[model samples]
Target chain A: MTGLSFRYGERVALDEVSLSAEAGRFTALLGPNGAGKSTLFSLLTRLLISRQGQIRIAGHDLERQPRAALAALGVVFQDATLDLDLTVAQNLRYFSRLHGLPPRQAEQRAEEELTRLGLWERRNEKVRALNGGHRRRVEIARALLHRPAVLILDEPTVGLDPPTRRLLVDHIHQLCATTGMAVLWATHLIDEVDPISDRVVILHRGRIRAAGDVPVVLAAAHSDSLADAFRHFTPESPPAQEAC
Target chain B: MPWLLALRGIVGREILRFLHQRERFLGALVRPLIWLLVFAAGFRAALGVAIVPPYQTYIPYEVYIVPGLLGMIQLFNGMQSSLSMVYDREMGSMRLLLTSPLPRWWLLVCKLVAGVAVSLLQCWAFLLIATLFGIELPGPGWLTVLPALILNGIMLGALGLVLSSTIRQLENFAGVMNFVVFPLFFCSPALYPLYKMRESSETLYWICEINPFGHGVELIRHALYGQVSWPDLGMVTAVALVLLALAVRGYDPRRGLMKRKGG
Candidate 1:
């Protein structure tokens, strides 16, 4: 988005927030707590709307053609949204049908996603019976069932163990590589940012502090490590170390 | 085709959830039956029945209240939708439904349809019980009442939708809804006829006359006798459309009650 700005009455949540995510690339939107990462995600998902700037998904403008733009995008919100009363396969099928998938194709894709996520055997189990890690995986699987061109996840690992987080991160990176899908990952943990593969955009106090490849961000901050780079970018409020 | 599929998914999920909550289905059914078998039994000695328009002869008090009991089931179902909607909004599940990439209005309407489907099930169950209880009615009335039942169901369900979107949080829900559910139910011709209220109080009669729930009950009463009230149907249709339009507007991201979150 270019020149995108938003406010909650008096306080500005995001100011002139401009960034881009390219196909086959993972852009990590790194920020401190209350740094507007969620606000930005809400805008991208069209849960919130602003008329200040441009947002395009697969070259379809968001405001002018929201249906086309949103159809091409997949999202996993920060909260657990799966219906606990429904079985794993039921949740997936519900989302698939919402996207207009045929019954036969919806079932096939749901199975493939559940299996790809190593959740095939538990497909009939109620989601309330699953642990946090498994629930996040189910949500991820649901997001990918429609094969969206662009994927976005907001703090998807907030409640999971480190091992599960690492597994999910690796799996998503592999998805970005193999599927040629554009990915925007918003997080506060500095450990999730890799200096070699992923691009980084540091947001501080509702503005982009630094943005580029990991190495470029480090070089711009005159630091060798991402921790120092993050400190340099967000001098007002440091990273949420507890999150790391 | 996709819109239809989404509606099926939404309505199916609601029914599935309703069935899973056996207590809820039983609870929905218990309220109307109590009024039928318990309250109406005592109410019979106190209230005398005259030749009302829908009644050809002086009918029993239980028979007089069958349509009102049906209206109560729908009214409670509509309020149930409101409670669940508020809970869903708090739980983040509502976000999943709203962001379906379909036109937002269509999604909200699908939810409305889902609520109506569940109410229809409970109404049918209640009617079946009434039939078994030896309450006599025209045999063809069963088929005739379907359309009126659906129309009244939508009108009330849409009211629930409007209530959900208008209220921002759950803590303030019950108090606000009581003000709505009780007043609308009691003031309507659900329990007693408007003419009875007219003899007691002039103001009360006009309130009943203006209440859409009364029209809904009247419509159902007429339909159950293989009749229709065009005026009541028109009132209900206009009210349903207006409420639905408001609900659709209320859920919009740029302008609606959801935006009050500012998150």
Candidate 2:
């Protein structure tokens, strides 16, 4: 969606935000806290409707053809949404069924996704029993069950440890590279952004602060590192610098 | 086809969740059973149940209040489903459901149907318990009352959806439930006949006459005796449609209360 704008009563939550995530590429939506990343996400996901601007998913206009648009989109929200009482496989199956997959197909897809996540062994285990990282993986697997053309994650690595976060980040990058699925990952952590071959869209207070490839964004900001470029746009505290 | 799968998943999840919470299932029963056993015992002693429309001869208070107790079961279960909706809205699980490709209204109808399905089980269990306690209902009532149970359940569930959407916070839910459940129950002829309420107060009688809950319970009472109350059926169905419409509007992103609160 381009030129999308939204508000909460009198307060403008998003102001003429415009950007497009491309196919077979990772688009990192970089924003600090309260930068309208969530609002933008909500609009993109069609959870909240913006009176201004247009949104399309996989060539389907969201407002005009919501069903087709939504069917083409898969999302992993920032909060934990899996039913804790349900088994890992059960959660996956439920999600596939929601996506309209029949029982046999839902089972097959659930198996494939769980096996890919290396969680097939623990398929019968309740989500409550899994660690944070494993649960996050399950959510990712759930999002990918129907093989949506566009995959978006809102702070998907929020509570996981550094190693787990790194693993998830790498896995998503690999998935994007291998499957040619358009990926948009929103996060405040600067370290999550790859220095090479990744697109970045920086949103500051509901407006697009910067948008482009790693080198383009770096050159545009005239900075040596992404952290510096990020600091130049957003007034967030010093991010955790990469350890040498 | 996708909508069917979505509906099944939704209903299946609701049933699974209800099963997981044994305390909730047991709690749904305790209130009605208490009314049937203890309160009915005292009420039986205090007043007599005149021969009602469904009753050919005078019936015991236990037997007469059975339908009302059944209505109470669905009412609470419906509100309970609403409470969960509020919880889902807060936990962001609601986002998970809304993201599905299926229409949102269909998803909500699935939710209402699922709640009714669970309440049907509770009502059956309550009826069994009542029989075990020596309350005699017509044997055919067990089957005849199913449709009535479903109708009342949907109407009450739709009411809950409207309530849930208007309520912004979980903390306010409990207060609203009590405020709603009590008035709807008491204002209706759940405990006594409208005639009894009329003898007490003309105003309360009019409230009972118009109360959808009253019609629902009366419908159940008539159905239990193998008779159909067309007036009650029409009233319940009309109210159900209105409430469901309101609920759908309440959840719509652009037009409903969701626009103000940001679901």
TM-score of each candidate structure, all chains considered together? 0.98, 0.97
Per-residue lDDT of model 2, residues A144-182, tens digit only? 999999999999998788999998999999989999999
DockQ of each: 0.64, 0.63
DockQ score for candidate 1: 0.64
Candidate 1 chain A weakest lDDT stretch, 10 residues: A235-244
Residue pairs clashing, model 1: none
Q: Candidate 1 falls in which docking quality class? A: medium
Q: Runs in model 1 with CA error above 4 Å?
A: A242-244, B260-263
Clashing pairs for model 2 are none
What does candidate 1's lDDT look like per residue over B223-259, in tens digits? 9998889999999999999999988887888873445
Weakest 10 consecutive residues, lDDT, candidate 1 chain B? B254-263
lDDT of 1: 0.88
Chain A TM-score, cand. 2: 0.96
